[model samples]
Target: MTPRRIAFYAPLKPVDHPIPSGDRQMARLILRALEAIDPAEIGPVEVASGLRVYDGAGDPAAQARLSAAAAAECDRLLSLYAAEPARRPALWLSYHVYYKAPDLIGPAVAHALGIPYVVVEATRARKRLTGPWSAFAAAAESAIEQAALVLCVSARDRHAVEAYGPPDQQVAMLPPFLDLPPAIDRSETASPPRLLTVAMMRPGDKLASYRLLADSLSRLAAQPWTLDIVGDGSAAAEVSALFAPFGQRVRLLGARPPADLAAHYRAADLLVWPGLNEAFGMVYLEAQAHGVPVLAIDNAGTGTVIRDGVGGRLTGPTAQDYAAALSALLADPSSLHALGHRARAHVEAHHALPAAAQRLRGLLTGLMS
Candidate 1:
């Protein structure tokens, strides 16, 4: 059978971008899932374009410049695909389309090529329509309106997307997922229980998560547990300062590649992060894949990934509540291991790559026919 070619694009960050982030990680995972889905029926996905239309600062000037770049990219892609009919995709998939980073090129090129345009994670920020990000928000909304199907990542995202969805548009949830990691030994816990955190040291929310985590940990100082942080970024000094009081109890190993993280996940009992504003964190999935349970301040996004008493425990978004939750878990050492068992099982059954690939396959194949 001749393969049905698919074109993939990520305006926020390309899959091959050097930066390490949850958004980039999810983008990469979605690409892999697409490739893994029925190869005989779907051709190898092509990176449609490297041109980024991101305007994080919401500056009107930047949006104008990015809009021009997107227009030029569309012209270039239209010509290229026209020159080679076989290279033209049957479907176009754009990942992570939102106000901060809109799919300005995907919709235009897909419309011109007359292909079914699919969006993996499209967010609708109506509030941004009149804010500093008004121009980018308008472009994002326009691009979303043209999508044949929008695969939202969480229920929080699904509400707004479905509310604003066009009459013929389809909106479905494609939960965050990751390639399964090798099973952790789970038997090497003679020492104090190990806790892990893997997050970038960026300013704003990222730093805030770290600060809240630090405060939570302070309450558990009496408990016997060690924390290993695996990440680095611009606010490294601030993050380090936040955890400095712990002295030798906390270890910041700097940033590491995805592969290196498996060892840390395997050795840890719980992967803790106060996931403030996280849109279904990839690290939680990563940790659970390795049979390590997760602990996070519960919110719309974290709730999707962390199931209380199932995969892990969730607490109110206060330092005291989070600390108290951790204190209880530490008091009962066996409960941590028990949660770890459920954590691995939960991920294998729901969040594995194969599961995501199947969901994407069913959703996308239905569109083509």
Candidate 2:
């Protein structure tokens, strides 16, 4: 039987290279997960640069022209998808479904081609309509209406999709899976308590999260812990300033290779992520695969990954709450070890890459049939 050709689409930049941001990492992980089953299953995955507004000190007219050029490029890609034969792709998969123009183009093309359109990590919150992202919310609603399958990462996101009144067969709760590297052979005693937080220091609210993380770590000055922050972005300087007081306690290792990252995960004991919001954090699974538990906030999509007291602890989304959780976990080494063991087992039992690939294959096969 011919394998169904899946056309993957990411509205943001493709994760072919190391970049800052969870979105890029998620895109890379999804591509890797599909490839784990069959390299040929995914065909000609394309990415469109979604609407990016630049408000810099540079010329405004040039920025406008640049934006126009980017939009035109997206239009050209959509036109190419439209001109392709209906049988070109057995299905179309989109990573995120909320960008206004660039992100909408691929879904629109998929709809035109009469292929099963699947969206991953889609959300629909009423408050979003009152924010700057209102245009994106409208586009997301339209896409949800046309999607054949909405693969959500959390119950909250799944509920949000159901609230939109999607067709019964069109929604799936597929948690993010991990294709982690082989666990490194390291004696736990040889290394200090390695705490990993993989994220880009972007110039936005994410920087605030980093600041909170640093503040939380400051409270743990007496603890024997070291943080290895991976990834780079626009707010690198600001993040550095936030971590400066920690001195040797914090290491800003910017954007290591994926292999290096895997090694870091294996050598680490815990992953700390204090971000305000996440669609679905694949890094948590990556850490768990390496026998490392995550310490994150119990908000939105994050709680789905870190089960309190089972694999790891989920605290309120605040610096003080994270600080308290981190302090207690680090203070008890034996508990940490047990939690790490349970974390690994949890991921193996639930979100193993092979199992996730099989699920995806089954979805594609059913769609094509």
Candidate 3:
């Protein structure tokens, strides 16, 4: 018998999306893990649909349009499978399913084709049912209910999803993971301590994180440190202004691809980003994989990536507290280097791609039977 194909989809952003983001990176990493699985049994992992169903703005009008688009996509997929039965997939796996960007295409086609449907990095948002995202929210709820499994990337997302998911629906933990970057002989020059931040310049939670970062950096003005920011977006002007006061101390490198950012990661003494709403920041893993330490404010998501005194320091919420913690680290160079060494080891043990592949192999044991 021929190996059955596995269909992979990312509704928020296609795995091959042009822009570089944590979401796109995670989708790519998930595909990598799936490919790392027993490929002979799993078959080729294909991006089933490049149709992006994401609605950044919670506009009801956009949701309606996306609904129509999703319906058309479902129709296209069904017709394609009917014409080419051998090309039909045995399972459909979607990543990053939520109210804003739901897997509108997968569930319908999966149900029609009678294939097992699964979701990773799935979330449950009941409140959106009565808001501008009501239509999409309801659609998301239906898709989650139709899934054979919901592989949550964080404990917080799992708790929220499990509460509303069906009793029989399998919900499992798959910690956010990344492909460990190649080892770099970091030559941390004996200049002012270099602090790095890699995040998009967007509004909402991203903007909030940047604002908090600027405030925290204000407290470190007296200390000798150079900050390099690696990102760009609609709010680039605002992000630049926030760090303008620092002038020579800050260098905005615009946005960089993963390959280009490797050198920056190697040269930096510490990776600093508030990580306001992102519970699964892949950059944290990337930095750690390169043997670089990360510094972020304490929160649920921060806990997953950084452990205080282990990977790096997790400071209190307040800017004062964050600054004080950073200052202490800057004062103790030996401790900072030790933290970087530990951070790399921690990610290698817990968040590497091979570990995720093994977890997937175990979780998907009976999925097709």
Best-fitting candidate, scored by lDDT: 1
Q: Deviation in angstroms for 155 in model 3?
A: 0.4
Model 3 lDDT-worst window of ten: 182-191
Error of 1 at 42 (Å): 2.6
Q: Estimate each model's TM-score.
A: 0.96, 0.83, 0.97
- Ranking of all candidate structures by their lDDT, best first: 1, 3, 2
Task: Summarize candidate 1's per-residue lDDT along 17-99 as a digit string, tens digits.
Answer: 88889888988889889889766666778998887678767799998998898899999989998788778888899999999
* lDDT (tens digit, per residue) of candidate 2 on 167-250: 564788777776655654434522467888988778665787798888899888877888889978889999989999888878
lDDT, model 1, position 49 = 89
Q: What value of lDDT does candidate 1 attain over all alpha carbons? A: 0.88
Q: Is candidate 1 or candidate 3 better by lDDT?
A: 1
Candidate 1 regions exceeding 4 Å error are 1-3, 188-190
Error of 2 at 367 (Å): 1.9
- Candidate ranking under TM-score, highest first, comes to 3, 1, 2
Write the residue-wise lDDT of candidate 3 on 1-369 in tens digits. 434788899999998889999899999988989889886757778888999998877899998998998899899989998898878988899998899998999999899988889999888888889988998889898999899999988888888888988899999999878888776666543368889999999998888888888998898888888999999999999999999998989999999888899888888999988788786688888888888888887887878777788888888887787788888888787788888888888998899899999998787757865
**Model 2 TM:** 0.83
